[model samples]
Target: MSTEVISQIDVDRTRGDFHYPEQHTFDAGTGLSHATIDYISDVKNEPDWIREFRHKALDVFLSKPMPTNWASKDLENIVFENIRYYLANAQRPTRSWDEVPDDVKRTFERLGIPEQERKFLAGVEAQFDSEAVYSNMKKALGDEGVIFVGSTDGLRDHPEIFKKWFGRVIPTGDNKFSALNSAVFSGGSFIYVPPGVKVKHPLQAYFRINAENFGQFERTLIIADEGSEVMYMEGCTAPKFETATLHSAVVELVALKGAKIQYVTVQNWSANVFNLVTKRAVAHEEAEVKWIDCNIGSRLTMKYPGVILKGRKARGEVISIALANNGQHQDTGAKMIHAADETTSNVISKSISIGQGRATYRGQVHIPKHLKGCKNNTECDALLINSTSRTDTYPAITVRGLGNSVQHEASVSQVSAEQIFYMQQRGLTEAQAMSLSVNGFVNDLVREFPMEYSVELKRLIDLEMEGSVG
Candidate 1:
């Protein structure tokens, strides 16, 4: 119940400044219209059915009104007509990195995509602006029947498999942003693991936005066949622009019977970008799906990764962390829908707000009356670093089935003077003390991240904490 808050915190101003010159082979120009949709479909040479789907989704996006109550009033500022829907430097993805355009390759090089792939990633895909410039998978995994490529490539090479579960998990009309993404979506990963195959290493994709007054919409689909296992990770960053930028992506995951799929995302958009995304998964009988999400460095972000337990004995989990600095709002949480017997779901969310930033958690858990032996647990924690910082939690749970159990817990705490004083007495600078305290508060969750990401997260936190305290 302690409500004390600090006055101010130091913020790093140059963490996301890497930008490359815009080099596009094709551009759809600004605004959203039927002609725009037609231009996009024509550029990609999409099939008639796919083109029709895009037209339908565009109508849905236009007909639906903006959400009134779910997000902050800042949503009113988004000018759809001012955003360039698509930009691409390459028409087709290249299997060799050398074939990638020089400017695009330089951007990824600055982001360390090639280095990461050389060190540990089993496959790597890099998207610049609106289309993937480079995509490559380890030959050994491909020999094992693993399909890792850009979505466009997936549609072109393996339509039979791609069409089977592309929109099955999350329909195009799920939400306004989803519908919009469907209309002008461009580059994202498409992954498929064969039955009984286990990918020994994780696959990764990196998304970069390099255009001004532009919007990046990527559509991703992942399918793990029965008795298969796979892990996919995605990282996104955008250059700083004076005008507003938009990034809205849709990701769908399907884990078949006895399959396991783990999806991880680290989003570090520039402070001028609005990052709104939809990610969901479907777990079949005895299947398992997990989402590890980290959000930081955006003007405003609203994301809620969710899972649907569609078959008996399925399990789903979501672990999330968010950091909101000045001029930022992180509204994030998770959803679990239990439609089968003996299913389980868990959610753990942690957030930190600094300066005038705000963080909110909105979650939902549902168990129908006919489902039996269902279980759910949700925990949300928030930390305040400035007097003007704010945090909120809203959790809704519904259970009507016999032998069903649900638990929810939330807490908001501010940095205490006593802890800072104690650390200062030990010869640490006040800023260092405050940083250490904040790090300790989320240490447990930070350890859950992969080593490289964990190191980077700590560095970001330390930078944000420098000169925060007198």
Candidate 2:
């Protein structure tokens, strides 16, 4: 219960050994150019359309300037010419864990992928650097017409399904980073569920970045057929590096009529990484889509997962939690667009700032005039652990329909010394007390996560809080 004990907890948290020796067989040498894109396309042996798609997206990326108005000035430091766009040890993914390369398997073992798969996951995909080294799904789900594989495999084997929805949700021109992802995206999940089939267990993916001064661009797409239900979860981590790393991904989801799709992400990048991603979903008639996102560590992260209710009675929801430590910035939020009658949406965001860290919430909710009976609710809350810590909230809600209703609420609170003292008197250390208080702040939303993820989230928050106090 002493201050020294709490301080030690902080030290232990940062003592993790995440470094691994680079064992790549191929590297697309540093920089972004037409040649790099063409090489990536040729290496994949992709269809001509896809190869052309990459070229067009590269042009779009070149035309757009780095966004400076809302993002941190750190964005200017990303030297596109110095970052290696692709690095892979193997060309094909292995279905059996034993077949995976020893070093790659060891990396996943450290991340708890195999154990988690053995315990409860319906499927598991592991991506190391720019390639999915391992991918497997439950035979039962496969029998029910579930297709879960890497994007490359999906396009090659099931073009009918993959081609129809690949870039429909989030177009290549959606943003600068999205265009970058489209140009050189290598490893990401591709999921499709048949109509009326409900996946009982969650499908999971783990992405690890092991190389320094490199970029990982994974493109993921999910399509839930009519009356089907599926839950997909992804986790990401990068080893500590002195040089900056880039992680730019694009995820798109499509929920068909009367279907439900839940997408969850637990992103814990190292302090030297820039995590910029674009994720969006579209909900059809009577369908539902939800995004549960948690951002813990990154030098600068700018991500906003969004949903578009495209049909009558569609629904969308976003629950986000962000924690910023010293020398880190967590800029995250959600977007919802109601394009049909009787659509509904909700947004709940929570942030924690500690030791000069900064957190920002930028959200948007819109309902057009033609839509009737649309509804929306948005809440943003922030907790500051130190006077030097800072937080910001920007919620933009636009409702043009007469029968639509929208509500927005925001609050900022700081951890009080008295509360910490009281908890310490109760036999808890300062670190424990702070961790408990911070956990309680987001307990309501954390419970929304699956049991395993919630436990891991709590552990991450505890470690983060340890570093914040004292």
- TM per candidate comes to 0.95, 0.97
Please give the clash total of every predicted structure, in order: 0, 0
Clashing pairs in 2: none
Candidate 1's TM-score reads 0.95
- Measured by lDDT, the strongest candidate is 2
Q: For residues 1-470, could you state the per-residue lDDT of candidate 1 as single tens digits?
A: 13322211211344456676776779999898999999988888988878898899999999988877677899899999999999986668899888887877777887779999999899999988899988999999999999999888888888899888877777888888999998888889999999999998899999888899999999999999999999898988887889999999999999999999988888889889999899999999999999998887789999999999999999999999998888899999999999999999999999998888889898989999988999999999999998889999989889896799998888999998898899999999888987898899889988877778888778777776773454
Residue 412, model 1: Cα distance from true site in angstroms? 1.1
lDDT of 2 at 452: 98
Model 2 scores worst on lDDT over the 10 consecutive residues at 10-19
Could you give the C-alpha RMSD of every candidate to the true structure, in order shown?
A: 5.1, 2.9
Give lDDT per model, in order: 0.88, 0.92
Per-residue CA lDDT of model 2 for 1-470, tens digit only, reads 69999877644575333767887787888999989988888778889999999999999999999887667899999999989999998778999999998888988887789999999999999999999999999999999999999887888889999899999999999889999999999899999999999999999989889898999999999999999999999998887898999999999999999999999999998899999999999999999999999999789999999999999999999999999999999999999999999999999999999989999999989998988999999999999999999999988888995999999999999999999999999999999999999999999999999999999999999888876666
